[model samples]
Target: MKIFGLTGWSGSGKTTLAVKLLPALIGRGLRVSTIKHAHKGFDIDHPGKDSHNHRMAGATEVLVSSPKRWALMHELRDEPEPTLEELVRKLQPVDLLLIEGFKRDRHPKLEVWRPSVGKPLIAAEDPTVVAIASDGPVPDARVPVFHIDDAEAMAAFVVEFCGLRA
Candidate 1:
């Protein structure tokens, strides 16, 4: 599967773009999946839940299932962190995979930039950044740029970049 990343400063609207792009990609008959990275501790399991108890009891991984949904949680447990490539390998095959973080990974990326955040631009330093989607006018770039609200254009960029049938 081809992989691409969407990255930006906090509140720069990466998730918003991702949310918009997924449906468009799916409409083009592509199977897509996403990997979102979180820096802070997060728990899908709630307190007083049986799955939470199982996890606290040293279970390395837990799969909770119901007719409607399923979730798999794996404990890192001090292990060396998995790289983006390794993580992608664990995912089922798809036409494209959109990764939200792992900004340092060498795969091609589309940066979501908002000048209001006053955050430095990563594309200026990273060759993996193939393009940018900006909430405001993007500075002159060596790669293509798209307005953040143009989900169709962004989706097309991704499809072409990946050489996917679209």
Candidate 2:
């Protein structure tokens, strides 16, 4: 799959941009999948659910299935966190893979920035950040800057940048 990324600091609207970009890419007839990285502990299971119970009982991997969907939850009990590429290998192929929040990964990324967040731009230090999407003008950024609300234009830029048609 073609890999691209969206990275930014906390409260910079990376998740919001990812959600907007999803439909824009899908509307263009591309099969797009996303991987969202969380910096903290997260739980997809409820305390009383069988899957949760299984996990609490020390099951390493718990797969919960129903008619509409299936989810596989793997416990990284003692293993080191997997690399982005390692995670990619586990997914089915797609036209695009939108990775959110792996700011340190070397893959090309669009830095989502909000000046109000008061964080420095990652693109300034990371050459892997190919573009910036900001809530305000970033005149000095070396890469192309897009208005955060302009998902269609950003989608076009991503499609061409990744050579999706090629």
Candidate 3:
């Protein structure tokens, strides 16, 4: 699958952009998947849910399924975090894979920037950054720059970057 990354400082709208981009890409008939990286402890299970009870009962992996959707939750018992490549291998095949983090990975990426954050732009330092989506105009850069509010345009850019026919 083609991999595209979204990276930015905290509260820089990466999640917001990702959420917007998915449906737009899907609207264009592309099968898209997402990989979100979280540094802190994260859980998909909910309290008082059967899946949560299963995990609490020492089940390492719990898969919950319904007619419409399914989820596989795995516990990394004393293991190191999996890399982006490994994580991608586990995902269902798609026309594109939109990664929400893993900025350090060697893949084509877009930087979601917000001037309010006052954080340095990663594109300024990372060559893998092919574009910037910001609420404000971005400084001159080698790659295309876009406005954060325009999801359709950003989705189009991502599709072109992946060499997909609209």
Candidate 4:
């Protein structure tokens, strides 16, 4: 899959932009998938759920399935965290793969920036950051800048950046 990433410090609206971009790209007739990286421990399964119970009972992997969807939860137990490349290989093919977080990974990314966040721009140091989407002026930035709310323009840039047909 052609991959792109949305990255920023906390409260920079990365998730919000990702949500907006998904439908915009889909509207343009492109198949899209997303991978989100969390810094802390997180759980998609809750207590008392069958899948949760199975995982708690020492099953290395628990797969929950239904007519609409299925999810596989693999317990890392003693294994190292999977690399970005390893995780990407597990996904089915798609026209675009929008990654949220994973800022340290060496992939093309857009930095979601907000001046109100009081954080310095990441693109200044990270060569992987190809562009910036911000609410305020990024006068010092060398890369392209787009208004944070301009999903159409951002989607168009992403399509061309990934060399996607639509």
What C-alpha lDDT values do all the predictions have? 0.89, 0.94, 0.90, 0.95
lDDT of 2 by residue, 1-166 (tens): 8999999999999999999999999999999999999999899999999999999999999999999999999999989999998999999999999999888889999999999999888888899999999989785799999999999999999999999972
- Clashing residue pairs in candidate 4, if any? none
User: Which ranking of candidates, highest lDDT first?
Assistant: 4, 2, 3, 1
Q: Candidate 3, clashing residue pairs?
A: none
Task: Please identify which of the two predictions, 3 or 4, would achieve the higher lDDT against the true structure.
Answer: 4
Q: Model 3 off-target regions past 4 Å?
A: none
> Per-residue lDDT of 103-161 in model 1, one digit per residue for the tens?
88788999999999899888988999999998787776878989888999988889988
* Most lDDT-accurate candidate: 4
Query: Model 2 TM-score?
Result: 0.97
Tens-place lDDT per residue, model 3, 19-118, is: 9999999999999889999979998789999999999999989999999999999999888999888999998899999999898999999999988999
- Which candidate do you rate higher for lDDT, 2 or 3? 2
How many clashes does each candidate structure show, in the order listed? 0, 0, 0, 0
lDDT of 4 by residue, 35-90 (tens): 99988889999999999999999999999999999999999998989999999999
Task: State candidate 1's TM-score.
Answer: 0.96
* Models sorted by TM-score, best on top: 4, 2, 1, 3
What's the lDDT for residue 21 in model 3?
90
Candidate 1: list runs displaced more than 4 Å. Answer: none
Worst 10 residues of 1 by lDDT: 134-143
lDDT of 2: 0.94
Write the number of the candidate with greater lDDT, choosing between 1 and 3. Answer: 3
